[model samples]
Target: MAEKFSGKKFSGKTVYSGITMGKVLILRKDPQIRRVKIADPEAEKERVYGAVDRAKQQLAALYEKAVKEVGESSAAIFEVHQMMLEDDDYLDAICHMIQTEMINAEYAVSVTGDNFAGMFAGMEDEYMQARAADVRDISVRLVRNLSGQEEVDFSAMEPSVIVADDLSPSETVQMDKKRILAFVTVHGSTNSHTAILARMMNIPALIGVPMDLSEIRTGMTAIVDGAAGEVIFEPTEFQCSEAERKIKGEQEKLRLLQELKGKRNETRDGRTIQIYANIGSVSDVGYVLENDAGGIGLFRSEFLYLGRDDFPSEEEQFQAYKQVVQTMGQKKVIIRTLDIGADKQADYFDLGKEENPALGYRAIRICLKQPEIFRTQIRALLRAAAYGNLSVMYPMVISVEEVKQIYAFVEEVEQELKQAQIPYRIPEQGIMIETPAAVMISDELAELVDFFSIGTNDLTQYTLAIDRQNQKLEDFYDPHHKAILRMIRMVVENAHKCGKWAGICGELGADLELTREFLDLGVDELSVAPPMVLKVREKVRGI
Candidate 1:
């Protein structure tokens, strides 16, 4: 059933209210890309196992030209593409092909039992869509390398919005931020790197525009109102006026937020609440400092592992960690090391496909099994401590035994650091009180760590046994459910009784209505998305 909506415009603006037959923004993309078959299915064709290496050399040349012509950061964007070409598992199959030397791209790719590479490229999911660019970027670079083509000068390219099927992290980051007005991808999510980078750059962007967005001409005007999740294609007279008014309103709200920015988050009666930023990368470190956040309440170190094709080196990890610490200066930055789980981890380490991944291999369970991987991450974090106040946090700590084991490992690394005379910093360590077992051990767990940060998103999922992402149980996953609030109160009050602080770095932290309840429950700190910082601060201050 096609239901159309009609409503009067809000008092201050004009609107095109009648239902017109056109594409609408509802998370689905416009003119979905037709799946492409990369390799031939049946033939005596051969594979080039060393094709990725050829791709790497090509990317290096392109990057060299990019670095000299553009800024260093623009060139640095190619690292992931370079890393993709180096994926051992991905390249291993290519190397082990059994056939003649020459083959078509399809023949080369057809050796695999499953078309994971093609499927990965075809996915609508942001992270997975990013892989598409990775595969293609490497492929294109290899083609150029093999052809001995001269690199194009990036300096002369004019800034223009890219209208394409989709973009990978590498592809999105490579474009000139100054030149690109906005990205009109036929497919993507609000959380996609394309959307995220747009927000970061303050560029007006609309994702998932319906009906062949690529066909939208080069100079056609578009109003990418991401907040409203809509795009106005060559807006009408009424739309022009309407958009101007909405922009004014949004800008006024932002102005009001700026007025409240940097102001202490305290109640009129003198109750103080610590406001912090929830972050995953060094790029976010600057947001915390600029916004006067009390500290980085939840610094997810997963970026070191998440979204990467390979594990980052200890020194490489340290450089990223040290950047955050140095940028933070004296304030504390709590770093949560590698929170990969079977259910949430979209990585190469196949843990035997299971029916229910949520209840299976995840968090501490996966980390404990991969001791070498865990130790390397811990060692990198410890080394990063030499720069400033850096605290190590463990995620998905489910039981007393798990906490004891990981804490013991931490001690082992500390002792090893001392013996090696490695200069490093080790701030107070803590646990993410997400799992029910960990929450049950609040008193005993608090004794083991410096503080507690409640991951309400996971806690809600585990406690209610409702996967928020499932959409089916979204109704049952309400944060306001009595059971969830009770559990939150139980965890918060328990932490306080144990003389420890409990902070919220979950989606609940930013919900305006729930903010009061969270405050009432005595949450010591609130870490939120960057956009909500000033609003939450203002709301908390008035309370």
Candidate 2:
């Protein structure tokens, strides 16, 4: 008879929320490499160069696949990988090692990758430290290509919980997503690309699990409780039954949410609100539609500017906007004009380093100073607006003069299009009420724009003088403070007095605890992450 084992449980940080039970699929670690002497160093250098080329091609393909699967923002990591491969310093280091050490290509790559990765790991900046994983990822790919080794064949495996020491962006993207029940890692960070992709994919994932790989075996049944951040191995019958019960409950909830599709987002008292979804790319429109969002309240257009060498041409921007506008089919699509700079830096922008970029030359500031870039995006938006329902909003606006300047630019673009005899329509214009100045003077700003969208994330940060990115201020970063609610009420009332509709497109929009309060505050709409649409709708109905 088989020996019985007691159930063991360990806690970790939850990357995504949900519960899943499946067999354990422990991923093997990378193969160890040993240095080997090469008779011809020059030949090995050529081989290394060839491997780099192949790696680039592989990354390009992965980029295309990821774009289709997860969307552009998440897929941009592969593009970054391609650029890293082309970096002269990185390539030169590998070549120099191969020639000077007279070693095989794989050994030189392994050593150089380790050295560079170690350097990045030692950096104080979290972003730079994250690049250590990228270095290791590309190195593994190159080593595999040189050795004629194949990638892990996830396609042939059955659906199970994916257990790994840590996963790189490439490895996470290349896995057969359909076969993955959940991801459990021994070591990972919430800021890691793998974590981001897992959340976007809507797969339950956990990181920092303190478990010994040797003690676990493949095919052992395991339970992943993402909400509790716990993983149970060889779960007892009672634990298994509880997991099954929770799974069934979740399935039932999903079924009921599906029924809410095509239903009105109206409260019990006949108060109606528009529930829209915020999206970063065209690929995310699928989720927006699947979740039955009334429309896209915030389409972050900056994704077009990121992950590229230079500005996206007018036609490129037009086609992207048009595709989204047309797909929504009469549903209002509010595209936020490039809100780049700050934490989101693009190399081609040549934006000099700033001491406080969040308050520096960004958003409307960059647009006003650089009219050529602004005109390009405005012209494209105008052309795309001709196809379907579309509107544009400017971020970081704090003055009437800025609004007037934006109007002048839009008029110039419209005149240019008119002279060229191009078909277009001037869509609705709005500004994000993110700054304290914007909110305080919202009454005046309301008259200049067609609508208002409250961006509570920034408003709360600026109002409280707390950097949202700082973990040290977590205790003080209270979004529910009376000050924030008062500001939202002020903006909504101001917009209403001017006969303009107001909505929220921030994290607070998805807070179920505040949904009733928002409705009572006379807010017209709430735009949140796609996954929260139904839950918010359900909450609105209950109230």
Name the candidate that leads on TM-score.
2
TM-score of each: 0.73, 0.81
lDDT of each: 0.64, 0.86
Model 1 / residue 91 / CA error / Å: 17
In model 2, the Cα lDDT at residue 251 comes to: 85
User: Residue 490 lDDT in model 2?
Assistant: 97
Q: For residues 361-443, could you state the per-residue lDDT of candidate 1 as single tens digits? A: 77767779998888888888889888888887788887778878987888899899999999876777888888787777787
Runs in model 1 lying further than 4 Å from the true structure: 1-58, 61-164, 177-211, 342-352, 474-476
State the local distance difference test value for candidate 2.
0.86
| lDDT (10s digit) by residue, model 2, range 126-159 | 5677679788888988898788764555658899
TM-score of 2: 0.81
